[model samples]
Target: MESKRSKYILIGLSVFCILLIGITSFKDGFLNPLRSGVGYVLSPIQSGVNRVGTSLYNGISNYSTLRSAMAEKQALQERIDALVEENSRLQSEQFELQRLRELYDLDQDYMQYQKIGARVIAKDSGDWFQVFRINKGSADGVQVDANVMAGGGLVGIVTDVGAHYATVRSIIDDVSRVSGMAQQSGDTCIVSGDLTLFGEGRLRLSNIAENGDLKDGDRIVTSNISSKFLPGILIGYAADITTDQSRLTKSGYLIPAAQFDSLQEVLVITTLKEEEAPQESTENTEGAQTGA
Candidate 1:
């Protein structure tokens, strides 16, 4: 019975809605004022709802756009950082390659000498590499008095060695001295190091014969009679050559071929000066035997 009553109420409401629509269609209908009053009450409410919906839609769209822009910005920043790191790595590699090429050319310049490459591992106090240690030692055939070379010319001699490391005293050391000769004039001179004067990147050249032909810019090399240094190895260029006050000898400065301010890698010539003399003696003895 309750179901029947609800069915009847729904049918009656549907009929009433159709009749109300017909009545409202007539312009002179009795409900015209009532319809107008209802419209006036609900119009503002409907407009307000529509405005709120539009605002919500616009807000959602703007928020999505901002989020996308932020994501893109973050990605671009990461890309820029990666590119900067790559550029730095490439620059470091290029510099290392240039240094290696210089060492290779130096090796070719003294092709007659057998050498082992070694890296500088430590140093004494001061700005110059006046005294430093190398990674090679007696285990690698490095020995005391073995010549150490870098930067296109002679750098130092190995002074001490252990099983795994060796110490070098460069030509710029305070007590270092070399017997050098002018390559062009065949005149001998003394090349001495002074840590104080090497601040200007030059060594001392003195005791040259007064009548010697050595001049400014002449090439100087290790003399043949040098007890320790190998013969014909370039030391540096003569500069500021002047005659002594007594007219007995000439003294001047030498701009060293090697730069001692920074040392990273070097070549250790395993050949000892003492060993060379014995080889020459042996060759002489063989020649004498052949003549006999």
Candidate 2:
């Protein structure tokens, strides 16, 4: 019976607390000072929480905007790099085009011979460029012993020919030789290349007559005695001349007019000189018998 009385007392206390809160809410005049003070203290805490939430939201938005901006910047940088590369390529192409135009003008000035314009395709596959391949070949009328020129000067002679390509032995090659004459002095000499004498930028001009009047800076040109190369093509310029050990002939160095190392486009003379035919056999034999 005592336990049952304790339970009833606890239930009565809860009912009194509920009635007090209900009356405070319904009656406007029941303004308790303690409750009002507690609410005033908590209002500042609620406002502070709201401010913290708003600041965090703004910070997140700003961070997202910064990330997007960085991505855009990276994209723009890539585009700029691409544009720069393209601009460089176009400039190089323009320079090459200008160079080819100059070559074309030089070719037109030499219209006496049938010429075929060809690009240098490859250099010899060895340490030295003893031979170089041109884009023109038998199909283009290029043949062995054809004269090859670049930049208004003789560069080489075609040594081998294929259907679509031809190989030229440049003037710098050791095996190449040309009959040359000093334009100013009228001194005849043989222009020969030696690999060991390359770095000096010169070719050997030997067989100069002891009495020849060769001087410094005399221009050398292909002589009429040259069997393969056409006569009058510029070979090089004469340099210092010295007597041989026996003093039988004079030898000198020649500065090649054509920059063989930097050759790009060359013209190949395709037409060969027609040989003169002998007189008719019957008429010649009758004249020879009468003279005998």
Candidate 3:
């Protein structure tokens, strides 16, 4: 009896499930209301899941775009920095070239003398290049009293020399005196360096002959009688000329041709004026002996 009861229960369950399926298949079935209630319960959950997925995707996309933009900005900035550095280097080279060209032209202007280039290496404690040193020395044939020229005119003389260095005393030094002559009229005068007067960019002009015709704006050059300086090297121009109180000589100021404050490269004439004296003395001595 137990076995038969179990079989009947199984058959009844199968029939009930088939009847439920048939009832729910119709358009106007009794289960329609139930289906509507189940859909209403799940609709909000599905909509919420779709909205969350869209927000997560957008957040990831925006992060990627920001990173790309930042990388591009950094690259552009680096390029700009490199270009700026290159431009600065180019400008510095251009200025150096111009200075070299000026030096070359000055060399051509006084081509009669043999010259060697020397850069200013050190200087005394002052605003002016009253005394300075050069990189060249006796090893380079730089001797004492060698004339140094720069900036289109006479600069100074080499006073002391070393194996690899040399000291220069510029024309602006207080003890400096150069015998200069007017290029226009050949009138001679004495140019004395005075640091006090150089504050106004001038040197003292004295010992000018009363009858001399050297006037304002006359070009002053190294006189042929100058013992140290070579002849015809430009010193400066005359200015503010006046007669002395004694009425024996005229005195005034001279504007220097070479700038004293910013001496850089200079040309040292390797030929010394003293070198010519020995040969001249020998020639005179030989002539005297022949006459005897």
TM-score of each: 0.75, 0.71, 0.73
RMSD of each: 10.7, 12.5, 9.6
Better of 1 and 3 by TM-score: 1
Q: Is candidate 2 or candidate 3 better by lDDT?
A: 3
Report the lDDT tens digits of candidate 2 across residue range 42-146: 999999999999999999999999999999999999999999999999998997787688678757756777888899889966554558888998998998878
Using lDDT, give the best candidate's number: 1
lDDT (tens digit, per residue) of candidate 3 on 17-80: 8887776676457667988888898888888988998888898888899899899999999999
lDDT of 1: 0.86
The C-alpha stretches of model 3 lying farther than 4 A from their native spots are: 1-70, 277-292
Clashing residue pairs in all predictions, respectively, total 0, 0, 0
Stretches of candidate 2 above 4 Å error? 1-62, 126-128, 273-292
- Pairs of residues at least 3 apart in sequence or in different chains that clash in candidate 2: none
Tens digit per residue, CA lDDT, model 1, 1-292: 9999999999999999999888778745767798899999999999999999999999999999999999999999999999999999999899878777888998898888889999999999989998899999999999888888888888988888899999999888877878889998899998888899989889999889999999999999987777677878889999999999989999999999988987898999999877876323322111111000
